[model samples]
Target chain A: MFYDNEMTLSFRAISSNEAFARVSVAAFALQLDPAVSEITEIKTAVSEAVTNSIIHAYDNGDGIVHIWCGCAGNKLYIEISDNGKGIENIETAMEPLFTTKPEQERSGLGFTIMQSFMNNIEVSSELGRGTKVTMEKSIGE
Target chain B: MSVGFKTLNNCLIVEIDGEIDHHFVDNVKKSIDSQAVQKGYSNIIFDFKNVDFMDSAGIGMIIGRYKFTKKNGGITSVACLSDNLKRIMMVSGLYRIIKIYNTVEEATKAV
Candidate 1:
C-alpha cells in the first residue's frame, strides 16, 4: 500500500540514457527526505538496474526501459523494467562479480551493488519476455 | 566529464570532473589511458573532488586503469572522494588495491 504518490518514466535503452534514468528517479525520490547516503544508494541501485536493462536486456539495442518510484511513509520503492531478452540463470546473474559481458569490461557487481545498498531487492524474468527489478529502501532510516 | 592531466614527479595526475556512470566511462577510460600509457609515467593519481555520482561502472573504469598501470610496473592512487562514494568504494573492495589520499598533493607525494 503506497501512502505517497508515484511517478513513472520510460526512456530508450541506451548508455547515455542510463544516467538520466537514475538521476530522474533519484530526483523524484527527494520528497522522502533521504539523507545524502540514502540518495547515493538509491542512485547507485537505479544505475545498476538501468545499466542492466541497457546492456544485458536489449543487447545494447533500441528498446524501452521503464522506472517507477514511490514513497510510502519513510520507505522508498523503485522498479525498473525492460522488454528485452531475459536472463537465463538469475541465480548466476545475482552472484557477486558475475558478469556475462566481461569482454565489455563489465564488473559483474551490478546486482551485488544494488543488493548491498537496498533494503530489499527482487528480480523476476522470463526468457524472451523481459526482466523486472523491484527494490525497496528505508529512505529516512 | 572533463579530464585534466598534470605531470608531477614522473606521475600522471588525472582530475576528473562531473559524474561517472556507464555512459561516460568509456570516454573517461580512453582519455586517461592515452595519457598514462603514452607518457610511461611511473605512477598515476586520480582526483575525484568534483565527482558527484558514480556506480559500479566507475569501479570497473578505475580497476581497468589500475591494471594497465600495474602491468607496466606503475602504481595508482586516488584522492578526494565524497563520503558517499568512499562507502561505495569500500564495499566494492577498492581500498585493497588502490591507496586513498585526502588530496592530490598527498597522493602524488606518497605514490
Candidate 2:
C-alpha cells in the first residue's frame, strides 16, 4: 500500500511573507519527523527559492508565486513556480555569489544554499516563460 | 529567535535561543557583532544550548563572526550544539575552525 500527500500555497512576492510560507510548509510536513536541523535546512531552502522568484522573476509586483509539496515513500518533493521574467541564463544564475541585484544586499547565495540543503535540485525556465524549481530531500532513516 | 549578550572575563557570550535560518540570520549577526564590539570584548562564546535548529544561513553567520573575531586576534567557540546541528556543522567544516565545547563554562574557559 502507498499513500500520497500533497500541499499547495500561493503568496505575494514579498519578503516578509516568505518566512511564513517556509514555516508553514515545514510544519505541515512534520509527519516525516525530520530532525530539527533538517527541518531548518528545508525551510531555508524553500525560503531562498521563493525569495528568488519574488525578487528576480517578478517586476513591479505583477504575479503570484506558487508552491507545491508532496511526500512519497521516504522522499519529499517541493516545487516553486513563478510566472514572471524568465531567466536568460540559468547557469549564470546558479553560480555562487551571482546576483542581478547587488545593491539590495542580496548575497547571491540563494541557489547555493538551496543546493547545499536539498538532496537534489532541478530548475526549468525559458526566456519570458517563467521559472520552476523542484527540489527533493529524504526523511528519516 | 531570541538573542542575549553578556560579558565575562573579557569574553563576549552570545546566547541564541530558537531556530537560526535565513529569517533570523541577519538580525542575529548584527545584534551579536554590535553588542560584542560595543562591549569591547576580544574573545567570544556562542551558546547554542537552546538552539535545536539551524541552516546554511546560520552557518554563514557563524563563519562570518569567526572571521571577524579572528581578524582582531580573538577566538570564538560554540557550546552545547544539539546532535542534529552538530552534524550539520561538522559537514559544513565549521568544527575545524571553531572549537566546540560541551558547556558554556567550558567554552568560556577555553576562549
Q: Which candidate gets the maximum lDDT versus the true structure?
A: 1
**Per-residue alpha-carbon lDDT of candidate 1 for residues B1-111, written as tens digits (9 for 90 to 100):** 688999988899998898888898867788788888788785889889999888999888888878888888988888999997798789888888889899988887786
In order, the B-chain TM-scores come to 0.94, 0.95
lDDT of 1 by residue, A1-141 (tens): 845879999999989887788789889889988888888899899999999999899998989999888888888889999999999999999998888887677888899899999999999999999999999998766
- How many residue-pair clashes does candidate 2 contain? 0
TM-score of 1: 0.96
Q: True interface contacts reproduced by each model, as a fraction?
A: 0.69, 0.10
Supply candidate 2's per-residue lDDT for B53. 69
Error of 2 at B89 (Å): 1.3
For model 2 the local lDDT of residue A79 reads 92
Docking class of 2: incorrect
Candidate 2 stretches with Cα past 4 Å from truth are: A1-3, A31-41, A51-64, A83-117, A126-130, A138-141
Lowest lDDT 10-residue stretch of candidate 2 chain B? B19-28
